[model samples]
Target chain A: MSPLSTLTPRTLKKPSPARSRLRGGARYAPTLATVGLFLAMFAVGAGMYPSFLSGQVFLNLFIDNTFLIVLAVGMTFVILTGGIDLSVGAVVALSMMVSATLLQQGWNAGAVIVLVLLIGGGLGLLMGLIIQYFDIQPFIVTLAGMFLARGLCYVISLDSIPVTEGFFTGMAQAQIPLSGDLFVSPGVLLALGIVAIAFFVLHHTRFGRTVYAIGGNEHSAMLMGLPVKSTKILVYALSGLCSAVAGILFSFYSLSGYSLAAQGMELDAIAAVVIGGTLLTGGTGYVLGSVVGVLVLGIVQTFIAYDGTLSSWWTKIVIGGLLLVFILLQRLFARKAG
Target chain B: MKSLLKHRLAWPVIALAALLLLNQIFRPDFLGLRMQDGHLYGSLIDIMRNGAPTILIALGMTLVIATRGIDLSVGAVVAIAGAASCAYIAASPDPGSPVTAATAVLIAVVAGLALGVWNGFLVSTIGVQPIIATLVLMTAGRGVAQLITGGQIISVSNDHYKSIGAGYLFTLPISILITAAVFALAAVLTRRTALGTLIEAVGINPVASRLAGLRARNIIWIVYIFSAVCAAIAGLMISSNVTAADANNAGLYIEMDAILAVVIGGTSLAGGRYTLVGTVVGAFIIQTLTTTVYTLGIPPEVTLVFKALVVITVCLLQAPKARNLLNRLKAAPKPAAKEAAKEKVAI
Candidate 1:
């Protein structure tokens, strides 16, 4: 269906295989830049802090950032479809709140998890329907979704609910030893598993290609007979499902469900995705780049923690600066390619 | 009457009146006005006074949105402005003096202007998407604000400064007066000159506008700067009203509220057309809705749910797809109704 139709070169002439490889490499420029930056920062930390070189410290980054990685994976899907989901952070909180309340009510832990995930996905589906059917702007629709989810959280409980369920607390305390000294939490493993699945789904699936096609040019994708509507809707639903998983991980990490938990966490997930090299305009990025982005963020925080003198606000400044640089690089690359 | 009904602002104005009526039904004395010591007092006045900040911000937002851009950093700008001014006031030799108050206001406005310039540069010069460009400041601005205030809640007992927010002038809140003045200025600047047309041109089609000899970048720059300055002025009012600058909480989610107000006022988010009058009415409607919740004894926290409902409903009503669906439904129902006409006519 496709082999003969693609014979016409996009440019003046078809590129040689090496030239194609070079062009492909250039497309990964932002992700590569992020990877390089992460390494440089790691080197700086290694030179400054003796403990930073420890293998456990590297594992700890995954442990502490488990929820973020999961959320960024979800965000990667939404951004890949040329949409943004501002409701992810709020949905995460809503999931946590529901889970904590249900647990306190003596509901089965597994049942609670499934129900909260469904709730998250349902809310996302509703937003997606509204956004797609009504043709409303994604940001405005997601913004309302954010308000609704956060409001529902307050309605559930204004106070933080401690998740003392036997299953939850047990999972929270459980750790898997990878070697003599290296260990990771159950949540870390769950997050990593999700990332692996996401990497495969995004790269190997037709849905993944459709997402990129839509992002590149939605009208053209529609004309090409792609299931644009359902894909767009499903992307948001996928993001919501991921957010619910992150919420569970977040609750495990903190061992409580606060109404205000994960406030602006969507921004963190987006920042990671952006810094990892996904263009905010959508399409042309890797899930692995996002993982590197999360690692970079974790290292920056660790560096500040080691310094001890810098205030917590420095984290915000550094992240903001990094976002600016990565976005500018993307702009430059886009200019050159276009 | 028909002309009045056809006016662009009719719906928002009617919505505002309906909200007031609803509040009156909840509280019998809701709409009552009283005068004491030559000053007027009423819920109506309170709505205007309390909504001044939102109204001011929404006016600038109208322009920015018209240029097909958004300023997410406005809320952050609010925090920085209040933090800067309050810190300066608290450090002044005479914190309560009028001169000190004037200096504080000037400093805050200047800070806002500078922030606007940064936003404008990022969008216009660096060519960052407006949402992402402003987002950089949105994330970092609070950090800057906390830095200015040294991470403390700065409070000043300055009467002159307080007057800007809480005090009255000619029986009306000074804040209301300030808002009215700014609204007038924006209206004149846009309507009296070619700025409004140029803005709409850029917003409608930047490339075409550029080809047609319009300075799209300058228009984008101006709107962003205007938005930032408006947010700063609103920040001053908020801080001056309470005589305190709480960096963390001041203007939190205000950008959302301002954007909502702008949208509800009949301005399309897609940009091109805007209504300043409608925006003011929208802000007033929002303020009344909040007050109405309090009067009905609904926990104000649930107001977010109500806001979400309102924004979605408004957007849906504005959406062309919704209308298309409505037409399809109508088309489906018409034949069935026509077929039943004989039976109905016999009845």
Candidate 2:
């Protein structure tokens, strides 16, 4: 027999149960790190500003980061499958523009929202199809999608359209009192619902496991007879749905939809996903981790605002630093696991 | 004739020629050039001058993409380089002096080198994905530039500095001259030396190249650094032409333009096999398209829509599946048995 055959059989043997468990734990280490980092940052903020320790302050994190949380959750699904959707920000902008334009034309708000969501989903499906069938890189295909969506947004309207209908305004103003001084808006509740649903879908479904398998090794996943094509397409479609939801929430948040809204928000989502412990290379991440990542970003911005003397741009710098550190940590974990 | 038609650059060159023809049809004087003082003046000259920055960046991108890697941080590097050089000039005791201007350029180029090293280290040594690694810089580099410029656009009034961007040299735009010199230098360095083959080898198969005793890591590292330095020079040209450094807007979307140029020039984003000549033609096509948008009286806001349409068309046409479909269409109505044989061979 060839030496290769001898070595192959030895390596192909199943790993020990304990060793496999260790590997599994190693996979979640980055997510755990993200959680720890979030807590530490929150604690530091509370120490710096006593007001930050209140329930109201905590609620504000969710309220402020509602759109980002939705985007991050959607991005997590895409990233988990070892693909990326750079068009999320542009799709968000397009959805906002479409909804706002229809709303301004006196269309029913509910009908408009559904229409926008479909448009977003369809666009994502198109990109997913091209990327899957044509063997194109996700980066280029999504980049093209970004340009197309942004261009379409501009084609729809060059100026911001304010939504003054009772439906949108009521949604924007509606709030649930959490305590004496804190309240959660409809947008926040919607974002939390998305997070919960994403958590369930990612952790409890075979489709989710298949996504992980594909990220781990596409060829192996194929050999195992997993439906790689459908799952990949579904991941992008899910991301598109999430972007549409986030855009609707943003409309409620700002009460206006401009073509330029959510500029660079995709990067922000990617950064959040990375910080939350989702590996850029895919296969290991948590939905809850991504929510924590969004909170981390929101808290950082709040802290900067409270400081009053610091530049707001410091938020970006801090996020960039966090991304670098987490990516490095991922490298370390990967090395140890190997 | 068939072989000539099959040349990699044939499509891009034809595209460029078609654009020029379209321009000429609209404006009779599109090709007319007259000596204004010692400098040439015409639409063609404008195309070269405006396309210089893109040509510079795409030249570097060609090599980087050839190595199965990408440098998305070039746009951020452009902003930072402009910020650094302009800030230095704005603060100098004698901003108008040649020495000060030289110092500013040196500082900007050095900043580029440092940023390149950082990217190289992250990607080559630490094993971060290129997109994510460059993204770290892309996100933060703008903030760093903002810090350098004190959250303001730094405007300078120096003839020597302005000349690098807006001035003419030997009856040609200095920007065009610089682009040409850089292109020639890169062609010589890559083709004359063994660097081109090594980069292609690594790109084609990193593990195989490493096993064959090539320094893959070093090659990867050098390309990232070279890409950044080229972006830095382009940044200087932009800021110099405007005589101001707007950190927020400087070199925005430039990376996309460079990548598109490289792709349109028939270079594969999947890595390996690049052409400098094709890149030059691609850059001219992009610049010409921008000029056409203006000449056609298309709204500036919708220019991106047209650009996206063109990019999609080019990419689809270049896709293997699309090409095969087109070939099959052309072969329809031929002998069925021969077609079946061809299909079998393809499979």
* Best by the DockQ measure: 1
Cα misplacement distance, residue A188 of candidate 1 (Å): 0.8
* Candidate 2 Cα deviation (angstroms), residue A12: 14
Write model 1 residue lDDT over A160-204, tens digit each, in one string: 999999999998999898979789999988998999999888888
Cα lDDT tens digits, model 2, B1-347, are: 88988999999999999999998898888889999999999999999998898899999999889988888889889999999999999999998999999999999999999999999999899989888999999988888888888889999999999998999989999999999999999999999999999989888888999999999999999999999999999999999999999888899889988988998999988888889899999899999999998777777777778888888788888889889989888877687878789899999
Total backbone collisions for each predicted model: 0, 0
lDDT of each: 0.90, 0.89
For residue B185, what is the lDDT in candidate 2?
Answer: 93
Tens digit per residue, CA lDDT, model 1, B81-123: 9999999999999888899999999999999999999999999
Chain A of candidate 1 compared with the true chain A, TM-score: 0.96
